[model samples]
Target chain A: MGKKTFIILAFQISLFNFFVTAQSLPEVKAHQKLMVEEEEKEEYEFARESKNEVEMVFSGLFLGYKKFISSQDGNTCVFTPSCSEYALMSIKKHGIILGTANAFDRLTRCNGLSPEKYRKDPESTLMIDKLE
Target chain B: MNIVKEKLSVFFILIFSLLGATKGHTQDLHQTFAFANELIESEQYERALLTFHRVLFFGKGSYQEEIFHQMGTCYYELQDFENAARYYDLAYFAEKNDSIKIELTFKKTSSLLLNKDYGYAQIELFNLPDNLNPYFSQKRNFYEGITYFGLGNFTESEKKFLRALPSGNAEEKEEIKQIFKNLEKVEKISPKKARILSMFIPGLGQVYAGDWRNGLNSFLLNAGFAVLAVQTAFQYSIWDVAISILPWYQRYHMGGYMGAERIAYEKIEREKGLIYSEILEVISETKTD
Candidate 1:
């Protein structure tokens, strides 16, 4: 009787193990948390330290103009980059001589004379005449 | 001894009963799949995906291929072609039957094609065995042609597309042949010519390219700068004109030519796309007929 009981108990334990194995379910993968890394441009920074004396002077003047005069002038430029900002960028990109000329051209183009010439920026509804 | 024997008998009965219950639960997998299918039918794909995944998790590999295929369909419906292609690939490998594998391969290629991964789609089509059956062969040829077309290999695309047509249908084949020939003779405006025209005269290239308004704007801007230079030269000096006005004139002049070239290129690309769509329409009509 003791031997018979041991065999029955062992058989039951095996059956229990089988059922447990069948019941074990893997966790579902979460597709919602897909990793998407986007490169976002930082729009504002203080200034880059200029290597040359001329660039240093221009940067200082531009910063001073922005802080004192341009701040009080309001957002009046028709282009998305604005005139003063375009001047700073163009100068930074192409040095003072050509950059100054580009800035003056931008000012002339800002006159809203030919609205059909440029696409309106979706955000600002301004003519999108960015420096080439 | 009597008490021990009675307790052991009760335990045995309990174990049997539990096993029966477990079996009954296992039987409910089919019903669960039906419920998931209903969710799919109702277009509740997200819910259906979760439910189907649940079935896959619990069921003991009973319909693994079908479940994977269903999941791929769900992802496809959601327009997530990347995931759809992945699941279809899984289904393709898991399936045992040849016909079903062919179908899954076609589906996987389609997902890749729709995602605009033409290179990968072409590779997948090439991996398929040559000439398994007529119906799938035509499908493979058509898909290969589309892949080649997307890759801008027009000659290869033409060959594959012609092969995809029925051999017996001479009239339809001739019509498709004529279309491809017409595509070769398509009158695309030369971007270089447009640029040269603009360089010769501000906005002339744009006018020739059918964008008169932009051309007018370019001409006016250049003329304004020219007038400014002359006025500055007379009022102040030629030095002031050189410093202030010349740069503006030069930029607008260069920009006008470049813009004309871009406009011409875009118009030609648009025309090509329209022709491609027309070809596809004709092919689809022939198929339906």
Candidate 2:
């Protein structure tokens, strides 16, 4: 082969390799972009779902109790049966019913009027009547 | 060979870019976690709760236990004892060290106590080592006595009181003495006499017990209830009769009598307590002087 033809052949091969590499660049870039986007979406979703879980858990604690007490001192009792019942209902609705067991024990054991002397003096039942 | 080297350079650049992006992502996560911790330390609970949730459910494996424990503390401070108890239970279960476990258990027990779950509180107290702390032991026994009294297990209550008495300080000793004296007087008061005095007037028995203040208060309270009962009965409101008449009047009148007897016994005990305290104070002052 002549020197000029050989040189031309070498240039043609180099040009071919350049196009091939350049052609794959966009595809690689697209793939990387897609993966990054997916990672971001997943992270966002994880954060959103986690926030909802926390809110649901918190709401379960405040259910049935007013946000503010009308009393002058701003002290509100949340362990009353009505408030506790609401909390339990919220917990059940949120599929977090496991939190209600302790709450129930608290209401009945701590807040309810003692039933021991109720039979002896039925009139004393008014102790808890204020709730009604 | 030169063309191959050029291609290799581009490949290396791509790998380095990916590594940089990953490094940035991790740094962002760390920053977010740090910010959450700062909020917690500053006691911005509501805001901290949001950040902690981010760390707990979204952040990687760093500081998860600490975040959860902080969340429980937030709930406790908010007076949401139920939620506090739940989170403390979670923290207790997740804790690796014995000291953390014990501390979490104490917090859980405190939440239960605040929520008024005396039964479960008792359960938790019993589960703790007897030598957890002398102060805790004394408080545990005292609360146990209170729970027994609330449950009307007088014998058991007295037993607990006696157990706690020996460990008590001067103030506690006086308190225990008063409780013992009251128990004795309650035992001595005749149920028949209480019923009789109660029938005579709304709160005459209380007056006999030297609890004139309580007697007067009971008298007025019962008289008010009696008036309301009479009005409701005449109004032909059977519901009112059922509630206001049978229960309110009868119970208050009877309770007045019982209250008087109880107060009489309580007064005697209180006087003894006062005397005991006075004697102790005298001894203490003399020693200090």
Candidate 3:
């Protein structure tokens, strides 16, 4: 080929190669990492501090009942949180008045009558119900 | 004719044997690098990483920077961001060329960012010289903006993001500013308001929080308990009503308000998640150099 023709062909090949390289370059994209700050879960502990004397007394009585009466009764409750613990939690959170009432409400609901009302706990056969 | 054929066969066999021996003996550093690169091209990052390590173990200091860079790429492909960052750091230190060093630093920072180590990414980004090519300077600003965003400094992030774009690209800059502006108005439910609402009327809080099913259930349960209490008081003595029906009424009433508060809090969290995803979408769609 003549020199001028060869130069033109060389220039075209170089331009083609440049375009190919540019096309093959990885596209810039924003990272999709989640920016949500994870909140640490607090561990549940029995015998946590009570807000008043009434609550303290109730907690002590509940603990005594669990150790003596409830323990001897065997794990008969069908609810996952169990009846006694639920009562304690309700009282601790809502105070003695409403807590006692909630405890009674839980007692009425624990008769295994309406199984479809609660989800089944995956860990065990107990129905999944907890303090709201 | 028979003798000529035998000689020709011997000559061909000698040539073939020599070629095979030469190929077997020439497992050089360049060839090893080529093989590792081929493995990387095939997406066999694990095997490529091993081969790169072998090259690093056996070869001299000739391909040190390149080997580290290759190893970083392999780790990046394997989704091992921590090791990718480490190798990229090594490559950055090993490289003498200013451009390659800048690229290595960017890679290291990117790896750190992907691992959500924003603090480290910021530090790496700050280590780069102020005087850089325009492309790299824009990239540095972009990375700094992302680092600050991850660290929850929106004002600084916005400033960095604004700086990241070219001075003349008004449309993209405005789009970014709009995304930041929308961040302030992200929908969030007030747990206190929800609780107050439920206290006045059973399940109202839950409904306000967009949990209609739970709200309906709460309303029905509380209303049912109230009806039962009234019926018990009429049929039996007030003492019987107080002992049995009153407790149930109180329990459901109190539980309803508490549950409303929790539901509202959860609703806020869900809304925040959606806003975050929307922000990410806008960012992904925005073009960067």
Candidate 4:
């Protein structure tokens, strides 16, 4: 009710407000810190290892096979036409003879010798022959 | 009475404002923490690491130790072993409780090993208390052996491996023994012999080491190239020789020779792996029966 009492009340209110503000500042800062820390933790846990064992084995096998095939001696030849050139030679040997018949029927419906024409056709056979 | 009412009204207003400010601060903190948690859970390690560093250095006081440990975890995940070791060391220093300290120490040692800082890793292992768990001891010894092996201290490596050998189960014992044999072979393989045999027969070194397929392939490849080179030379065309005798021919010839030795080395490794797998399979079958 007095002027002195009123002044003291205002001062006390100001001090309480300052203290509350200061306390909350730290809590807010701390919360931000915690969020960042958690993100880092997640990253660490999920890193990938370099190479798996199965992948390594497959790589080695493929490389070895490639090296072997590339180094084949030119002189050595397979009996039933060179395996590398099988389709070409087979087409030259059989294509004209089989060309008279229905193309799909002669190729797919017929048994061994007739189907061999389509099988050895250079355009289709070249790639498959080398793979084998 | 009117004056008193006005003063009370002001006081209530101040109280409400203070409460609202505090609540807002708390909510902001909660949101930040949640965001960091989401990043960590999502496995964005590098970003999470930066976030953690921000928290550890500039965040609230209560979570300092936890933040440091999490930073170490991030480094470990990223395969930054040196940094991981450093962070783990700090974490351990901050909190010396037995469980936390032991775990941190193990992590530090593992990071050091991964970094190929074997000397320091060994020192850390030596300092581990006798009361440390046996499983930890086994792992420590295994890592120590790997470090020694990497450093070319095969004698020390063998000793460490012997110490780590498990005696509890027949299968485990056999597996360890097989590893021991591989280590012995690795030690016995003389670089001189490898070089000499490689010089004499191109791929003879690999064949001597039991890599038949590789040795044969190497020998055939080199011989093939050599024949091509000679034929190209006899043909007396500069372009022919250049194409077949030089460049790719030389590279492939040298490669074939090196391949022979590499094949030999790989053959030894493959054999060891096969034997180990066989032992493991036997153990698993025995256990099942």
Ranking by DockQ: 3, 1, 4, 2
**Per-residue CA lDDT of candidate 1, range A1-132, in tens?**
699998998876545422221101110011111111232333335345676787778778877666534432334578877787788778878998999999888888888889999899998899887778
The lDDT, on a scale of 0 to 1, for candidate 4 is 0.56
Query: Which candidate's TM-score is highest?
Result: 1
User: Fnat of the models, one by one?
Assistant: 0.00, 0.00, 0.06, 0.01
Model 2, residue B154: what's the lDDT? 61
Worst 10 residues of 1 chain B by lDDT: B280-289
Winner by lDDT between candidate 3 and candidate 2: 3
Q: Write the per-residue lDDT of candidate 4 for residues B63-127, one digit (tens) a residue.
A: 66777788788888897889999999889888858877877877787778667687887787777
DockQ of each: 0.02, 0.01, 0.05, 0.02
- Native-interface RMSD of candidate 4: 23.0
Best of the candidates, lDDT? 3
Q: Which stretches of candidate 3 lie over 4 Å from their true place?
A: A1-30, A33-132, B1-28, B60-62, B187-289
Pairwise TM-score winner, candidates 3 and 4: 3
Task: Categorize the docking of model 4.
Answer: incorrect
Instruction: Summarize candidate 2's per-residue lDDT along A17-47 as a digit string, tens digits.
Output: 2222111222122212110111111111211
> What lDDT tens digits, residue by residue, belong to model 4 across residues A61-104?
43444447434222222222233233222333345344223233
Q: Against the true structure, what is each candidate's TM-score?
A: 0.62, 0.42, 0.55, 0.50
In candidate 1, stretches whose alpha carbon ends up further than 4 angstroms from where it belongs are A1-132, B1-25, B60-62, B185-188, B287-289
Against the true structure, candidate 1 reaches a TM-score of: 0.62
Q: State the lDDT of candidate 2 residue by residue for B225-284, as single tens digits.
A: 777777887888868678646764665565566565565555544554343333223222
Please report the TM-score between candidate 2 and the true structure: 0.42
